[model samples]
Target chain A: MVERRMPSIRTTRFSALAPLALVAALLLGAPMLRGIGAVQAADGGNTIESVAIDTPDQVRITFRGEFPAAQATAENFRFAEAAAPDAPMALKSVKAEGRVVTLTATQALHPTERYKLEVADPPISRDVTPSPWATLVTLFLSSALINNFVFTRYLGLCIFFGVSKKRDAAVGMGVTFTAVMIFTAMTSWAVDTFALQPLHLGFLQVLVFIGTVAAVVQFLDTMLRKTHPALHRSFGVYLMLITTNCIILAVPLLNAQGKVSMLEALVLALGSGLGFALALFLMSCAREKMELARVPKAFEGLPIAFALAGLFALAFMGFSGLDFFR
Target chain B: MSETTERPPGALQLLFNGIVSENPVFRLALSLCPAVAVTTTVANGFILGVAVLAVQVLSSLTVAIARGVIHPRVRIPVYTIIIAVWVSAIDMALAAFVPALYAQVGLYIKLIVAFAIIISRLEVFASRQPLVPSFWDAVGMGLGFMIALMVIGALREVLGAGSFFGIVLFKTKPLLFFALPAGGFFSIALLMAFFNALERKLTGGTAKPAAGGHHG
Candidate 1:
C-alpha cells in the first residue's frame, strides 16, 4: 500500500515549497503590477482646486472642501455659470475629502465654459453643535436597512453563514454584529479622520480596523461574561467570532471612504446590520425547512446551503427595481 | 517505531481529499458566505478563490506549527490574531495594488479572517498533522472551495447576466432572479441535489453516510 511508503525528504520539501512559490509568483505577477499602476493613476490629481466651465451648449463646475457640518444644506453652497447664474447646473454628486468638497455638475461644460463655487457660510462648528444628532438617525436607517451592508453591499458574509445555523443564534449574532459594527465604525472613523487622514497614516487603516474590532469584541465578551452571565453564555462564543467578522472591520473603512459624517456612519452601520439580520433570518428559516427536504447525499449540508443562499440572493435582487431613492 | 510507522496520509491523498472527498464548501460545508456572495461572476469567484486559498494555506501552516507552544485556553484567540494579521496584510496589499478587483471584492477580502474554512482546517486537520501533510490538506481543501465557488459563480453569472467573468457568453436577457438572493438559494439547492445524485451514482449507490448525519 502507498501508506507503507516513507515519503522522501525531497518530496516533503518540494510539497511545502510549491505553495509558497506559487504565492510568491502571484504576488509579483504582471497583472498585480499593472493593477498597482492603475491605482496610483486613479488616486492621482489635484488636492484642492475648483474648476468651472460655462459654454453656450453646457455649463458645469467642480470643487473640493472639508467635511460638511451636520446642518450644512445643499442650498447653502452656491454655483454660478456664464449662461445663467441663478439657474446654475444642478448638483450631480458631492464627494468630500476632510474640509474639501468636490461637487460635480450634471451637465457638461461648454467649450468656453466657466463657473464659480462658494461655501456661502462656514458649517456649524462641531463643538457648538450637537454633532448632528439627526444625522445619526439618518445614517442608522440608511446603513441598517436602505444601504444594508450584507444584502446590499455584501460585506462580512463569511460570518453571516457561519453563525446563522439557528434562527435564535442568527438573531443573536446579528445583534452582536450590529453593536460591534457601530462601535468599530465610530472608533475607526475618528482615528481615520483625525489621525490617519491628517498625519498620512492611511496605510494603518487595515491594521487599526482589525485591531479595533479584535479589541472591541474582546472587551464586549469580557464585559458580558462578567455582567450578564446568561446572556454571555448564549452569545459569548459568537462574540469572539466577531473579531474576524469582516463587516465589523470593513464598514468603518468604507464609511471613511464615503467620507460620511458620524451620523451618516451610524445610519450606514444600522442599515448594514439590519440587512445582515434580514439575510440571516431568511437563511435560517429556509434552512429549517431545508433540513427535511430530501437533499442528495453529497449535497447534504453546506452545498445545499449554498444553493439555498443563491435563491435568496435572487430574491433580494428584487429590491434593485426599487427606484424610490437613487 | 509504532508512531513513526503511523505516518499520516500522503500528499496525493491529502490533495484528493480537498478536491472531492472533504471539500471545504460542498463536502464539509465550511465557508459558504463568501462562496455565495462572491460567486456573482467567474472572475470574482476566481479571485476570491485565490485570496481564500492564500489565507487558508498560510493560516493553516502557521497554526499547525504553533499548536504545540500555544496554550489551549488562549489558542482560539491566538489563532484569530494570527489570521487577522495575515488578512490585514492581504487587504492592504490588494487595496494598494489591485484597486479594481479590490473594489469589486471590497470588504469580502477583509472578511477572509472570519472564514470558517481556515479555522476548521486548522483545528481539525492541520493541528494534528505534520507540516507536509498539513500543507497538502490545506491545498486540497482550498482547491475544493475554489471549485465550488467557480461552479456557483459560473452558473449565476451565465444564467443571471448572460456573461462569464464579465464577458458576454450569450445575448439572451438574463433571468434577473438568477442574479439575486432568491436565485442564490435556488441555485445552491438544485446544485446540491445534483451533487447528491452524482455522489450516489459515483459510489454505485452506496456512498458512506454523511458525517454527523443530520436527516434534515
Candidate 2:
C-alpha cells in the first residue's frame, strides 16, 4: 500500500512540474522558431533610404551600401500627394549622382507635412532600424541618462549589486570604476584603430578586449594597493573584480563597433562612467534607507535590494529615448 | 561548502545538492546579475542559462583537472583566465555557426566570464573535488541556475508583458512592474521567499535559517 501510494505521489509531483518543463522546452526552440525568413522585407534593390529636408523644395537623399548612380529613375521616385496616402505628388525631376540622390518637387513640399517617397528600389531601411547614431551631445546624454549601462541595460551587475550597499564604499567604487573605464576605453580604442583595424585583426576582438581589461585591472590593483591602501580595503577588491565587470569589456567592444572618433570615444567613456557612478550612488542611498523600513523575514538583504533595484529601473525608464535634435 | 561535506556523497546526491540545497542563485545567491538581467523573457533566460551551464561545466572540469597543478596563490587569476578563454571560444563558435541563436544571446555569452557564480563554484567545490564529482556538481548547479532563471523569466513575462516566451498570453500587461528591472527584484525576492518557506516545510521546520551572505 505504501509503495503504491509513493508512486502516485511521485507522479503528481512530475505532473505539477510538467508545465514548467514544457515551457522550458518551448523556449529552447525559440531560435529555430524565429530563425529562418522571420523578417525578410521586400524592398526594391534601390540604394536610397531617407531624404533629409531642410527646405521642402529640394532634399538630399542618401544611399547606403553602394554609390547612388545608375539605379534610381524619375518615374521610379514619387512623393505621395499631401492629402492622399498613396497618390504620387507631381515631380519636377529626380536626379542621382555619386552617392547622393537629389529630389526636386514641382510644388514646394510642406516641411511639416508627412511625405512618403516611394522608390522602385530602396535600401533595407524599412527592415532594419538604424542604430541611434552617436553625436557628441547625444552620445553624452544617451550614455549618462538615456541608455545608461546600469539602470537601463543591466551591465556590470556584479559590482552594482555587491558594493552598492554602503554609501562610502559605493562612492569609492564608482569613482574608481569611472577612472578605470575612461583609461581603458582610450587604450583599447588606440590599439584597435592603430593596429587591429589596420592589420584587419578584427576577429581577435574578444581576446584583445578581455586581455586589455584583465591587464588594466591588475595594473590598477597594484597601483592602488601601494598608493591608496584605505580605499583599496574598502572597494579595491571590487576594483580588481572590474576585470570581470562586463561594462569594462563591453565599452571597448562598443567603441570598436561605433567607429567614433577619438574625442567622441572619450566622451562616450566618460559619460558611461558617470552613468555607472550615478546608478551606484542612487542605489546605495536607496539601500541605506531600506535598512530602516519594515521588511519581511525572507525579503531582507539581497532580495529587498533587488526589489529596490527593479523600482529604480522602472524609474529610470522615464529617461529613455530623450533624443537630441537630429 | 566543503565544511558541510564530511564524506563525499554519491553522484545523484551531488546533483540534488546543486539543484536544491546549494542553488547558485537562490541558495547561494551568486550571479544575481544574469538572474535579474537576462530573465526578461523565458527564451532569453534559457539561452543565457544554457550558456552559463556550458561555461560552468567546462570551467569546473578544467579547474578540477588542474587543481593539483595550479598553485594556491595564483589559482584565482588562472581560473579567471580559463573562464575568459572558454567564454571567448564559445562566443566565437556561436557567432560563426549559429548566427541565429547568437543574435539572441551573444551580448550575454561574453559577459559570462565575469559571473561570480562560475568562479565561486570553482573556489567552493571544483578546486578541491575530483573531476567526475566536479563535473556532476557543475551540471547540477547549472541546471538549477537555469531552472531558477526560467522561473523568474516566466513570472516576469506572464505578468509584465502579458506574454510567455514572447507569445501574447494576455491582452493586458497585468502588472507592468513585474516586467521592469524592479519587477525582476520582486520576482526573484518573492520567489526566493517561497522557496525558503518550502524548504523549511520539506525539512519539517527544522531547517536552519539561510545565511543571507551573497558576497561572491
Candidate 3:
C-alpha cells in the first residue's frame, strides 16, 4: 500500500519543499543582515574571569566584560612561566570570541608547569566588538558540522542506516527527526533545570530523560495523527523509531552534562538535528545512486553503506580545524 | 510427560549459537554505534562491552522471571524500565569504582538502555523462555558482544594507533586513518563483509542471515 502511494507523495513533497527552501534561505540570511548592529555595546571596564589551558599549545582567557573590535596583539597580553618568570612565553596567534580570547604559543607548554597570565596595559583590543549571536552561531556550526552526531559522535547510526535506503524516506525522516530532536532537547533541558536539579534527583537523569523523550514522541505521534493524517502516515513509523534513537537521547544528556545555558542547549539541539538530517540526505542520495553499481556480494548491503559513511566522515573531519569567528 | 519428553537445545548449543551463528554484532548487526564508537581504543571498547554485557544479562533475566506478570499492553515500557534500572545501577557502579573508565564512557553507559540488542533479546528470547535457558542465552549473547567488541577494538588499536592494549607496538602509528572516526566506519564495514563471506563459505551458501533493522 505504501509503495503504491510513494511516487505521488514524493513528488508533492518535493514541490512543497521549494517554498520551505526559500523561507529557510531568508531566515538563515536574517542573522547576517543583523550583523551590522552586532558590534556590542561595550561597558566601561572589563575584568578577567579565569585563565585555563585549552590545549597543549594554547591558553584561553575568559573575561567578564566586552570590548570593541580591535587588534589583540600578543604584546597586549603577557604569559610568564612560573619557573622562569624572566623568560616569558611567546604568543603566536590570538583569537577573540567577545568574552573569550585564546592565545596560541609558538611552543607547547608543559602541562605540569605553572603559568601566570597578565592583561597588559593596552589589554585585549578596545576595538573588539562584542557579539553574543556570533558565539551562538559558532556553537551551532561547530556542533552541526565539526562534531556531527552521526559522522563524528556515532550517535544515530541505526536510524541513519535503516531509513536511508530511499531518498524520500530519508528526507521525511530527517525533517521529522529534526523536529522531534529540537522539541525533546528543549523539554529535557527545561525539566533538568527546573525539576531534577532542584530536587537533587540527578541520579534519575537517565530514567527521566528516556521517559521524557518517550512521552514527547508519543504526544507528537497522537497530535500529528489527528491534525495531519497524511503527514502522520508518512512519518508515523519514523516517529516511533525515534523514541529510542541514541541521538534523541544523547542531545539532552550532552546538554545536561555540558551544563550549557538554555539558549546554548536550544542551538545545540537545532545544530545536531540539522547535522543528522544533512547526513541522512547525503547518505540516501549516494545509496540511491549506488543501487546500480554494486559489484561484491559480501559488501552489498550494510558493508557498502558503512564504507560510504566512512568517506563522509573523512570529509567532515576537515571542519574540525576551522575557526569561523577568528 | 517427563522432562526428557520435552526436548530443547542444550545450554552449550545455545551459547555457541550466540557466539558464532547468531552473533549480535556480526550476525544481527544490532547496536553498531558503540561497536564502532568506543572501539577506537581497546580499553574503551572492552569497558563498554562489559557494561553492556552486565546490563543485557540482568535485563534478560528480569524479563524472563516477570514475563507473566507484565501486561501485554504495557510490556514495552515495562521492559524499558527494567533495562533502565539495570543500566542505572551499572552506570553508578562504574562511576564509583572505576571513575576513569566511567569518565571516558559515562554518556555511553547511560545510553545502554537504548541499545536494541538488550531489549530485543528480552522481548524475543527472555519473555518466552523459562529462567535457565534465558540465562544461558543472555550469557551467550553478552559474551559474543564482548568478544566482538574486543576483537574490533584490538584491530583498531593495533592498526590505527600502533598500540595493543595501550602498549605501543612501534614508534609510529601504522595508519592514522584507522584511529579517526572515519577509520572506524571503514574497519567495521570491512569486518562485516569479511564475516558475511566467511559465513557463506562455511554454510555452503545454504544459510542466510537476516537483514539489519531499526536499532537505537
Top candidate by TM-score: 3
Tell me which of candidates 2 and 3 scores higher on DockQ.
3
Runs of candidate 1 exceeding 4 Å displacement = A1-87, A90-141, A155-167, A282-315, A321-326, B1-5, B64-69, B92-99, B165-167, B204-216
Which sequence of candidate numbers ranks them by TM-score, best first? Answer: 3, 2, 1
Residue by residue across B180-211, what tens digits does model 3's lDDT show? 99999999899988998887898897656437
- Counting only residues 3 or more apart in sequence or on different chains, how many pairs clash (N, Cα, C under 3 Å) in candidate 2? 5
True contacts kept of 2: 0.49
Tens-place lDDT per residue, model 3, A221-285, is: 99988986777877797898899878999999999998889999988888888889889999999
* TM-scores of the candidates in the order shown: 0.67, 0.72, 0.81
Query: What is the C-alpha local distance difference test score of candidate 3?
Result: 0.82
Model 1 gets an lDDT of: 0.64
Off by over 4 Å in 3: A1-130, B1-8
DockQ (Cα-based) for each candidate = 0.26, 0.37, 0.71
Clash pairs for candidate 2: A46-A121, A46-A122, A310-B181, A310-B182, A311-B182
Between candidates 1 and 3, the DockQ winner: 3
Point out the worst 10-residue segment of candidate 3 chain B by lDDT: B1-10
- Estimate, for each residue in A49-140, the C-alpha lDDT of model 1 and write its tens digit: 32322222221222233445452445655655634556655765555445545455566543222344444454211101111322343344
Chain A: TM-score in each model = 0.58, 0.58, 0.68
